[model samples]
Target: MNGRGVITQICIIGAGPAGLLLGHLLRAEGIDCVVLERHTPDYVLGRIRAGVLERVTVDLMERLGLDARLKAEGLVHDGFNLTDGERLIRIDIAGLTGQHVTVYGQTELTRDLMDARHGRGLEVVYEAADVALHDIESDAPFVTYLKDGVQHRVDARIIVGCDGFHGPSRKAIPVSVGKEYEREYPFGWLGILADVPPCNHELIYANHARGFALASQRSETRSRYYIDVPLTERVEDWPDERIWDELAIRLGPQAAAHITRGPSIEKSIAPLRSYVFAPMRHGSLLLCGDAAHIVPPTGAKGLNLAASDVHYAAEALTAFFRRGDNDAIPAYSDRALARVWKAERFSWSLTRLMHRFPEDGPFERAMQVAELDYIASSRAAQTSIAENYVGLPV
Candidate 1:
């Protein structure tokens, strides 16, 4: 280490999937990089998140030769259902779009990346404290953090923030330089995870008069379900039985009949929000994943979106470092944001179609019903949903 800092070609903040995946990708190309995380390894893997994997994500893993366990364990979902409390309107994504989404847990995918770190020679410093970014607008950007009672610094040619929305990298950018777009929903998702079989082989997104519900699975033997609840409600207020009962009603009688209720392994209330920050890059600092944008979980795009960000970032960094391409660095923001806006739109539209807003009255409800009816009847509508559901090409 130099007197100033540990010098590297690239420095990545946040050891979440986005950061880890980018680290691995850079390493595979013989690039020197380091990742910093504010949390322990266990804490990072403990977070419960969406897992629908698009082709872009699958391709990256495959390209890295990291899909052995994923191929062996991931479930290939051909289609998913949308309902209006009466019947299911199945969108055959694979049939219509010739594409499929893999049902894999975010935790599991992170585990795969984590386990492969040592073999790939990727350095990830967990429990990094008070991480701060410096000179992002200048050619030489560096990161500093306190670890194990010693303050350390990392000087790099580039800094990528995969640290999520609340992380320091994004905040380091001058507020005047970036524009914020956000929509906070009136309700939140109350999700329960259990070690039981899913009610259905495929996902079911239901819009009942009572509320919105989604029945999903992490594996053949593990299920995850969610129901929209007023933001005022607390996890303590809804007991296991109460959540199960609500799921039964909102998911409709057909899905309810097959529900295998079990003790919740994890349960929480997550507020829904759609947020984006324009110009994902500011000088030497580049933002990826949640640091740049966020989407509601309605379309299961959160993790996949992060993966796509890493994909674009890895390519851009590789070009800059390997070929001395100055243009790729500046072009990264626009390329990543193009896909980000589309995913945000899809998630927002799906959330609007499925959730019952407190301000929604007869007209809004009728519009939702009409839209659902049109989607059910029209092949073109289903094709559009299928394309977005499986994800757009990167």
Candidate 2:
């Protein structure tokens, strides 16, 4: 569309949910853009799993005409259970605040988005595409990438780095203005997917002296579960019997026996951590989603936070592209950081409440239990959790 042979006005890197959803939104607005992904569509669609989504995200998908697939397949969780060895306390999210979380994996969301993008006849380059970004201060920021063993360069009015934490977009920003804050927890989550029905009707967050265990469902016949373990532990070290024994101990005596384990479709240790980079922008290049920040999965804010960030970026970019106003660009960091900090606080609080800290004494453990009890008993506290868990309004 330009003299430089750039086919689109914007080029988006990474076809993850954030990138794909942003592409969908921009396409609906008749904006021209292309998406580049590092993994094949099948791999991207099969590997990632994110079980929590806020009401705002679901509403946005519905408004954007992207909810049909989600509605037909997604599981709506109206409540969550908190257990401390013997007693089980359930917090009804919908009853508390008229909001609920939808159990949809990030991979599934990516699949749906890719389907939508393909249906619209949009282009998405996948598998080992190398992207080189240039001209952050100029009106036209060119993206050079390789496709099919051939080098290609495309010039665009703007470039969006929706790639995740491991992608190259974040490194493109000059290190002088960017400061990354990170913390790696001593523990990681051993996530597993089984073909059995859920052990509980709702999500169960069980805290025991052994560790933290989460029992959640993906579908009627499939369940998703997690157990906290040392960061250095390997999946191979956790045999089937060991995995089940840990789950049973943490889930307490009420868990159904003989719950079948599927082919261990997914197994990995997700290292817990919190990361944030200030100013999220340098000149015209902007970062969103995991490219900007990362949070421990304890609060289930990773995917939703990414969606919120991109939504804000879309709004800002729309204003600039249409009216030539630079106000939004300058305020991008502050605007996004506000929501980022709130998520950070919630994530850390949840992590603290559930996990056993190395330095935590009896008093701290008692305080954690008391906090959990307070949340379960107090309507005000439950409402606060519901509002955040179901997602805050964008």
TM-score of 1: 0.98
Cα distance off (Å), candidate 2, residue 148: 2.0
User: Model 1, range 19-46, lDDT digits (tens) per residue?
Assistant: 9899999999999999999999999999
lDDT of 2: 0.82
Candidate with top TM-score is 1
lDDT of each: 0.93, 0.82
Q: After superposition, how far is residue 3 of candidate 2 from its true place, in Å?
A: 15
How many clashes in each candidate?
Answer: 0, 0
Give candidate 1 misplaced runs (Cα > 4 Å).
1-4
Off by over 4 Å in 2: 1-7, 256-263
